[model samples]
Target: MSQQPYAPRPQDPRPRGGTPPSGAPPYPRHRPPRPPATSDLRLLLRLTVASFVLAVLGGAVGLLAAPGQLTGVPVGPAFDTFVLVGSLVLGFGVTAGLYALVYFPLREQRQWAWILGIALASMALLSTLANAALLLVGPAGASPGLVTGALKAVVDVAWLVVAVRPGVRAALR
Candidate 1:
């Protein structure tokens, strides 16, 4: 006896990347159907995931740059904690979070997302370069932050190269 392949029931929850029913509400973005992420796009996504690690490290770096000492003023523990928290929220944490935002629309073939991604990558490359340069030019020996910053700059450069790939640009367009 031959068995038939099973079909999904009408009420089944739609799987990701699956088409919606004809009568479903239209999306606001008005984007055309896009192909699955290109390898370069996938690489970009991976970089965003990696950025979270950088964000945490960035927060630690804030402790090293404590505001109390830099400003030459006495401060309470509460303020010190506040500064570190602010560092995490305002610095790489936000930058990394925004990268994920760019990923979704870029995967959906949004031109604006593509543009934003390019801008984001360029800024990241510049920031990491500056951070690494500061550490290298300082009197202090190579520290963990320096090594990590240098590596992050390398990754940012690679991300920018992938972001400009013909296939990646075409998909977003």
Candidate 2:
């Protein structure tokens, strides 16, 4: 009987590059290719961070604007109290939403980020629209408000578009 010569086993760390090293066992034919790692999540990250900061600032502003003195008002005590409570509620809600929707989800790369971001953007757009309408229709001297609202609406629209892109979705996933 004749004995065959021994050959060293080949080692290939990356099998996705096609073809295993010589002398290595044949690679599995049915293995699916892995999705490539996304390399462009900077915009999303920046948006998330900015949203967080804005949420905090908004909450602070709401708290500060809670109307401590109700002087010469036509509304009753209940209405004034309601206004205070509503402002506090809205402020805290915005802060919480930003944390839950944008900050945490973005950090974890969760799909909730997309949904929450869209909701946030839509809300922002609507709020800006309302502001613009008020500025245009309200008494006089609101040009600054109109300009700010328009700018905010534009930013909101941009955020909505970027958040819904296929690349952003893939990256989040």
Candidate 3:
């Protein structure tokens, strides 16, 4: 039998001289899911400020505990100098790095912000842990009587608090 006539395709009543069916959404209409407001920013900021402050204070303590570490570059019998120098470098480096990382979200870089934040937070945690270890293992053995030592302890705890903050953890997601 003869095939039935093909039904006319429904006509799009769009205005005549109007734009053609420009392929799906000109460009992909994908909008990344936004992250829920997180408490991490506060935590991160607190940690960063605390870490920086502690680094400065720790540097001061190292200066007092082992002045020679800075004044003179020891060629021998300078274990104190070595420890002081190593600690100062580590403390400053880690703190500065974390501070920078923690600020990424303020820029609202979205996913990148969270990524860098988590990475930096982890590093900060490790750095503080290492500092605590040194304080306990070295001669001081967490018995630092100086105000700077107390400051260092306070800031280290602050860092831990930030790392565990809900906002920061959410940012990681």
Candidate 4:
């Protein structure tokens, strides 16, 4: 029928000296996860570059494959060669150069590069959506061009979405 002094019991979850119980992590369990590692940033850079490259490559494929369908003139080997070379230049050459412009500076954590990369990503997303809208309005239904345009739009959106993530943005900063 008597009350004792209130005190932390032996089973108190909060360990002394701010240390966690045995087998627990050094940080609090509720602590937010650390920023992405350098390797992760590198991977993200590669992924974003790859997504754009793939989008360009897919465009090159569509140009070569479907443009001929749009033309009434007979296709020739020379025409095919021209299309291939042009796509290779625009897709592989130009895209590579643009990405290189962003990639190296971004790797070095340049603030301008971060801004430029975001701007470029936004342009790419806009271009994809515009192209998709064009394809949807065009006479072709479910054509390879339309399909590829849709695919590119998906990729571009994904790239921009991931590029804006806290980890990716922090890496750039």
For model 2, what is the C-alpha lDDT against the true structure?
A: 0.63
Clashing pairs for predicted structure model 2, backbone only: none
Off by over 4 Å in 4: 1-40, 69-91
RMSD of each: 11.2, 10.3, 8.4, 15.1
Model 1 per-residue lDDT at 13: 65
Best by TM-score: 1
Reference-based lDDT, each prediction: 0.68, 0.63, 0.59, 0.68
The TM-score values for the models, in the order shown, are 0.66, 0.54, 0.46, 0.59
What are the runs in model 3 whose C-alpha is more than 4 Å off?
1-40, 70-98, 106-109, 135-173
Output the better candidate (1/2) by lDDT.
Answer: 1
Q: Which ranges in model 1 have alpha carbons more than 4 Å from their true place?
A: 1-31, 61-72
Clashing pairs in 1: none
C-alpha lDDT (0 to 100) for residue 58 of candidate 3: 65
lDDT per residue (tens digit) for residues 1-173 in model 3: 43645533358434344554656354356777656556666555666666677667666666666543344445654775677669878967866776675565633535566556556555645665666666667665335424555565566566656655667656553
For residue 110, what is the lDDT in candidate 1? 78
Q: What count of clashes does model 3 give?
A: 4
Give the TM-score comparing model 1 with the true structure, all chains together. Answer: 0.66
Quick one: ranking by TM-score, best first?
1, 4, 2, 3
lDDT of 3 at 48: 61
